[model samples]
Target: MASSAFSAAKIVGLTGAAWLSGTIAAISLISIPAVSRTLKEDNLSAAHAVKLWRNNFEAGFALAPPIALATASSLASCGWAARNLRTSGVKDGRLFWVAAALTVSIVPYTIIFMKSTNDKLLRYAKKEKLTTSESQETEGLLKRWVFLNSVRSLLPLAGALLTSIVVLA
Candidate 1:
């Protein structure tokens, strides 16, 4: 039963990490660029688009903590199991720890780098009217947000890669 649980945890961890990496990639590569173009056309359109995007982002963000926790928990479990079994050949425990650390780092990264821009965008999206300066500022913020968000994506991708290597090894 414990073995089965460990296996399930590993599967869930890998799945969550992969899903997060893909989602971040899509947002960075596809969604942000597409939305940025749309945002440039008109303020009303930009407001609506941002609102929709924020809603989607919030939904995804809400799920991230649980997924990250699960991934970290699973990696820790694998390490513990390996150590208990005296698996001398499995140096992958360090890889698991690295992956878990990366997974856990996402929260602080988001808070430190992404939160201010996200808050500003959300506030701007709520406005009934946007002046030219406001629109330009929004555009600037969006560009910065996209760049920072791309950086954010890399953390999970690295975590996923590390986790994959550990699992496969």
Candidate 2:
């Protein structure tokens, strides 16, 4: 029963981490470019762009935390099981622990590094009408957000990579 539970946890942890990382990466690589192009259209107002950003943000906000927590829990369970099963004196679960830590760190990463950009985006988004200058500023802000978000996505990817290594070994 313990072995089966550990195996399930490993599968769940690895798959969840990979899925989270890939989804975020897709937003950065595919969705953002499409949004940028759409916003460049002369027919769309700044408000429209902001609305699109908000929709994306809300979706991601809803999705990320639960997945992160679940993945981290599974990784921690795998680590605990690994530690218990080890016969050697050396530490057994360090890789799994690190993987779990990296997976869960995205929350703080967003709060610390991505908050200012998010706030600025939200502040600008709330306006019914942006000055031409403010509209231009949104473009720059979006670019900054995309860059930071791309970096943020790496945390889970790294965790998934670590998990893969640990599991395969």
Candidate 3:
């Protein structure tokens, strides 16, 4: 039987992973699409689109990394405790470590995969006057970001799924 502390950590880690995944999914599915609609349907200005994107980015930046670190930390703790506390032949918490790795992998994924799109968007946001081509490119960049973020969201969700299987097993 797992100790109370290990049980608590498992709960925390699993919940955190689920929450993180859901949050990112919401941003990709709901928030970004709405902002994109502002550009197309509403015929809003580039500055308005950039402002909305910046708002979402700032909020996500403030929220996501800390949650990732906390979830990964909790998962790592569960892994350590499970490894040390095993008494008989049973599945250990090694998967928890993998979950931790997946949950935190979003950091590098963002830095590597999403950085170029993010940089381009930021550059566009800063420009005082966008050329007609640059304005057209904004839509493409936003679409690319949505796709990248959708992929990034899967990482934490996979972590959460792995954690769930291990716990239920």
TM-score of each: 0.85, 0.93, 0.93
> What are the lDDT scores of the predictions, listed in order?
0.72, 0.83, 0.88
Which residue pairs show collisions in model 2? none
Q: Give the Å error, residue 83, model 1.
A: 0.8
| Model 2 Cα lDDT, one tens digit per residue, 1-169 | 2777787888898999999998887777887667777888656777778778877888898998899999999998888778776532214778888889898888999999999989988887788989999888888888888888899889999989998988887
Q: In candidate 1, what are the lDDT values of residues 34-91, reduced to their tens digit?
A: 7777766553465666676677578768877777777777777766665544433455
Q: Which residue pairs in candidate 3 have backbone atoms (N, alpha carbon, C) closer than 3 angstroms, thus clashing?
A: none
Q: Is candidate 1 or candidate 3 better by TM-score?
A: 3
Regions of model 3 farther than 4 Å from truth? 87-90
Name the top lDDT candidate. Answer: 3
| Candidate 2 wrongly placed segments (more than 4 Å) | 41-43, 87-91
Model 3, TM vs. native: 0.93
Cα RMSD of predicted structure 2: 2.3
lDDT of 3 by residue, 36-115 (tens): 99899989877668767877877988999999999999999988888777652225878999999999998999999999
